[model samples]
Target: MQDKTNNQESSLTRRDFIKTAAIGAGAAAIVSMSLTEGQSQTQPAEAPKTQPSATPLKLEDVLKKAREKLYPRCRVCPECDGRACSGEVPGMGGIGSGKSFHNNYDSLAKIQLKMKTFHDVKKPDTSITLWGHKLAVPILSAATGGVTYNMGLKGKMTDEEYIDALLGGCIKAGTIGMAADGIGDPLDIYEIRLKAVAKYNGKAIATIKPKTQEEIIKRIRMIEKAGGLAFAVDIDSAGRAARALPGQTVEPKTMKQLKELAQCTKLPFIIKGIMTVEEAEMAVECGAAGIVVSNHGGRVLDHTPGSADVLAPIADKVKGKIVIFVDGGIRYGADVLKMLALGADAVLVGRPLLRGAVGGGQDGVALLINKMKNELVDSMVLTGTADVKKVKRDILIV
Candidate 1:
């Protein structure tokens, strides 16, 4: 492969190399952002355009471009259920059998929506006010990184380019994006990621891996400096310790440590990775302002229950105590409604937006989000739901 580098460069793109490596490694399929608190009274920074073109970009066009760029790194499959790229970790897919990822898709698929058009609900309000920041939609971009290795875009896209498109697109759509800290990322690279968060002027969230208390605190300080609205520790990343790069450490945090981390930041400190009622309650007790019920998109473990399956129970236990955000298999606008009915305050979407960034840049990301929002509107109208903040449980047949 090294000897053919020059020859391949003449005729091949990074996407092609990623496809070649996937075949050599034996893979069937592969696949698959906001704001600050406190301080300033200054006006927010303006968001950059998705592209310079004046012509409106279609969602299908974005997906086509993403499919070309992502190729085997992700098939940009119609379903995106982790089946095609089952064991393609360090690339896309999930860990081990990919059962957890499959469960995420299946669980959401099993949820049936009830269409009630008789009521006089023409326009459904999709806006949400999360922690005093009002948003156009309940959907926010999930924090994702490692574009060079994980997504195989080394030569084609830089981390900065990918994140800029991700955050910029979300901001343009009147929502927020997340900035991620890869387990292998050094402090300098993390600082670079924070710059994207800063560029949005406190309209993005920064997610940290479950490193030591000191490390988490240090990064929190940095995020505060960047005008980040909130920060989260993906405690599920603790399971990836064996896979972590040398000199990097990730460990599960005790309640005591979590409290310290929460108190360390004036910004709303979120604890991501809660999958059960017990832990959800614990998060509330630990002073977490918010909790993201995730399983790291099913990437850290195998055979786990889907986020949707586990969400309702957790929400039942601690719904009003902490802000709830769930991510896993949320594809369309109705999926967003189902989650709201399941008791989530809002939802986070992954994978699809990544495809947008890879295939069409900022505009692609915004188009995809707006498409979901429109779908959400249709869903609300069909279900006689007037507001996103108060979706009824009867809207879903479960």
Candidate 2:
């Protein structure tokens, strides 16, 4: 058998040789003096000839490094004045037309600028006290259904494991986990999350689908008994079936019905998918504790304004009367800051969590959240804000 270590050493270039030598020397010294067995073993046997100095890395640094490694230069085509044009290169494949706001780097740059300003502004207290539980951050894992179906990783994530991971990650991140109804039987999902919450000491927000007032009431009672912190109904999806999955129906709940449901649950009642001020006021009239200004991630309605677009108006209308949350196309910590600046109490993430789940299971999910949180803190520090609550609207241009 060939010696793998010898082969590795032989394959090292001159630069690698110098780097390894320096690293090895430093590692050997540290190992020799260190008492910890694990720490000592991590050091290389040979002294390194050229190694970089040991610099402590903050979470923000790690995330920045990761971002640089993961997302390269902006490859998407620049959108010209109102024309939908597709630009394709030989090796890069086809990139979508820049006509969509999401596809435009300039729009993203503006959002980033606003985010930085918000971060520089006084940091708002990110701590939130809702449903009798105090959370470290206002962000929540929005109730997103069909994740397993969409990702085609059903067998990879067991029901218990998935629930446990979601609950655990949420707790670790100091946020609440919101689970959508109709992913499975309501009672079964409730029970699974109940166990996860108890075990992880986490909070859960169960979103019941639109149903008859009586059924809604029953589900609310069940959620309360199951020890959930909040109850919600995704009103935007009501009376509609997902185009991705035609079998899944989202029956819309009326204001009267929502009011009755709110009255039934002792837990905080949140109404998801309020796109307009009219709907937001109705949610308040229906006695909602919070309103999530969402557009179902553009999965429900095409060509609708992004959630960020409507957040300010809705926040202005509701003022201080209700807790405001928003979700849609939030992929970074700066995005979270932008939403908060726009009057969102916090922002919810959906697809990112799913991506994390697919890529790394529970630990991957944790990594994804930790990365986001670190980015958020970095944004805060760079903008001169000390905490989450101090983030304000004046920090934004639009």
The best candidate by TM-score is 1
Badly placed stretches (over 4 Å) of model 2 are 1-109, 114-125, 183-190, 239-250
Cα RMSD to native, each candidate?
Answer: 8.6, 12.1
Error of 1 at 324 (Å): 0.2
Per-residue CA lDDT of model 2 for 57-147, tens digit only, reads 2323222322222222111112111122122211111123322224222333456443344333443345766756777666677765543
lDDT of candidate 1 over 1-398, digit per residue (tens): 88697786667755455465444434323222121211111112233432243345655566666666676678777678998778888878888999998999888999999989899998677788887887889889999888877898878888899999899878866789888999989898899889998888888999999998888888999999999999989999998677667778999889999999888779999888989999999999999999999888889989999999999889888978999999998999989999999999989999999998876677667777777887888889999999988888888998
Error of 1 at 299 (Å): 0.2
lDDT values, one for every candidate: 0.83, 0.58
Tell me the TM-score of model 2: 0.69
lDDT of 2 at 330: 74
Estimate the TM-score for candidate 1. 0.87
lDDT top scorer: 1
Scanning candidate 1 in windows of ten residues, the lowest lDDT window is 34-43
